[model samples]
Target: MSEREMETTDDDRGMDQLHVAGVTLTGVARGGVETCLMAKELGVMFDIGMCPPGAQRYGTVLASHAHADHLGGVHYLASLRSMFGQKPLKLHVPVEAAEPLQRIFAAWSELEGYQVPVEIFGHAPGATVTIRRDVQATCFRTVHRVPSLAWVVERVSRRLKPEFQGREGAELKRLRQAGVEITDEHRAPELCVTGDTQIEFLLSDESAMARRARVLVHEVTSWEAGDAGAIARTRRWGHTHIDELIAAAERFEGEALVLVHRSMRHSRKAAEAVVARMPPSLREKVHLLGN
Candidate 1:
């Protein structure tokens, strides 16, 4: 079945929902307009575009950059959570953007006559943070006009050590009682959300997790592959073109390659047509997210 056939919409909230690779992604992504996505199963939200409905539920938000379309909703989310008696929101953003965002939140607090409750952490490329006991997030640098990051969430599990693989249950229990470490921790990349970045991000050496993630949410702002000038213009603005993404698609070993942050100039129908014309190998894994 096609990705579109498995997709569903939430018109009341003005969000598009997609269930792929065993996770549900909910939110909107329109270039220069708004771009927020929630991976509820991971208890995290990527970006906070205008703080759409149901965003308050996620205790943690991983922001890719400071663009208005991606990070504009930071204050709104914090305030909403406070109003509803929820814990202070935990927001993780690029190190370069952290202080500036804090200043912005201070300004908002002064204007509102109340402090906005939030804990913002600045993370540089290669930084990792624990989202939950089994889930963690790691950020990597992306090529963009401003400092930006692509977040990868990994699920960690423990498996029996190779040496103990064939051991009987009683022997394993005895080893455990004797304080022997019988398992090794393994981390698997589950989802990767690249906020807004040039195509160079995918080609970079630091993009291993983005390529290996089970689900990759990438931006393709320019859908017109036929226009070389248009593709050039998109790169100048630090965004990806469909042609660039298609060229690099095979490098991604993920189950779902979700294309998002499409420019308003192209309609959904037009974008779907572009996907249809792609090589079958790339087409099957590519899915569009947004109305």
Candidate 2:
């Protein structure tokens, strides 16, 4: 897997762009401000940070939590799609935030004099949602101040079994005609997006799929280890520190470990300097998302 920075033109709506692991990630993530990311190839948007431009193009949204910065734009997304005559939006959020969000939509419906055309599905940890016949998303709990979850998008395909790999097309067709199963199903975890989480999420047992995904987008809000108590303070806020991530970097077996949700207190250059000082092996796989 290779990583390359993509130029963001006016059409990108101020979102940062990066291409890695066979997919392009476009969006912005800033601590306490807004965070939204879209994997166009997967047709899914993670979080709706103020519903930045071009967000309505995706029909499905997998929200990680109820934080305003992450989910504030949900209503706007639904409204924009409705205004343009697009299909109703499908939103999957944590079970705890589902009811309150529905109520918010109800109030919006009352104020607008029309029902909001958004379908909200509540999912608990370990729930899976089918995005398409060949694609699906699995949800898992993450440590955050709110009820947060991470999403792992996987693609399923069938390949010829080992015994049939050398068989000719005609023979494979014959085997199929004879009711023999000549192929085996393969599920590959393509992407994992953790909206906002503490370091514990990476250390938890539930992170198996996330750790193995081709692209892992995790949050790192605190970039500097100011003092002995700095790390603890960041954890108290339910955010991950760069130091914590560096220590556990080896646990991640992904092709790309993209760090995001940077706080305004730290400049991009400062973060880059920190990343540069990381161990070579881990630094090679680490990337900072957003401009």
Candidate 3:
């Protein structure tokens, strides 16, 4: 763990680096610097804080909000994808950021003397965006200084109807012939990525998707025992403090809980010490993504 921590570079470029429950999570997230996560298998990225050229391989990017620390590299990413002759990048963003982002792209096109191939889709809270045939991203509002969203990636599956569980194949065929629906669609939360939000977002019922996700990647920006005033600063800035995270450990039922976007003020050693102090079970389930 120590060696790996030391190896984390400014951009956190890697392939299939951190596998959690069949999904690969990799990114660079130091508070106020950058925050991005690429789920390689799903071909979906959560943010583009500092989009590395390699990220072009992912066909879609879901921007949580317009915060520069999270979506700063979007234009550069689009330009790179276009330059490499990759297919147009599909960007899913909050509805509020659509116009400004489009204007920025247009300006870039004018400045660079070429149009960047990019498709932008603005989604409102509680809206669902399809990522693929079996998978989709459900956007939910989160507490942030800007209009932000947390994405829950769910996979659609099918299960036999309760009444048809014991039916023989011939009987099932007969039922199908009669136009009976023998199977029910099931949606399971596979991964939840919270770009940057206050602790209340995770503690409230609104975050049910994150609580039930197989893997949760969340932001825990400030984790220091400075003073009462400093703790308030965390909340005021739309971030989560360390104490809040420790107190809310029991609320997370996910198989893995990844903590990212730690404050640059805290030393790596100090942050690890704080995580080491978590309850044994929670500690085992938690993985800190730090720089």
Arrange candidates by TM-score, descending. 2, 1, 3
lDDT of 1 by residue, 2-111 (tens): 24312322122656889999889999889999998999888789999798866767778899999999988889888877876677889999999989988999999999
lDDT of 3 by residue, 213-272 (tens): 999988888878556687799999999888888788798898998888888888768888
- The estimated TM-scores of all candidates read 0.94, 0.94, 0.90
Q: Report the CA-based lDDT of candidate 2 relative to the real structure.
A: 0.89
Off by over 4 Å in 1: 1-14
Candidate 2 wrong stretches, greater than 4 Å? 1-13
Task: State which candidate, 1 or 2, has the greater lDDT.
Answer: 1
Instruction: Write down the lDDT that model 3 would get.
Output: 0.83
Candidate 3 residue pairs that clash: none
Cα lDDT of model 2 by residue, 114-154, tens digit: 99899999999999999888889999999999999999999
Model 2 residue 138 distance off true place after TM-score fit, in angstroms = 0.4
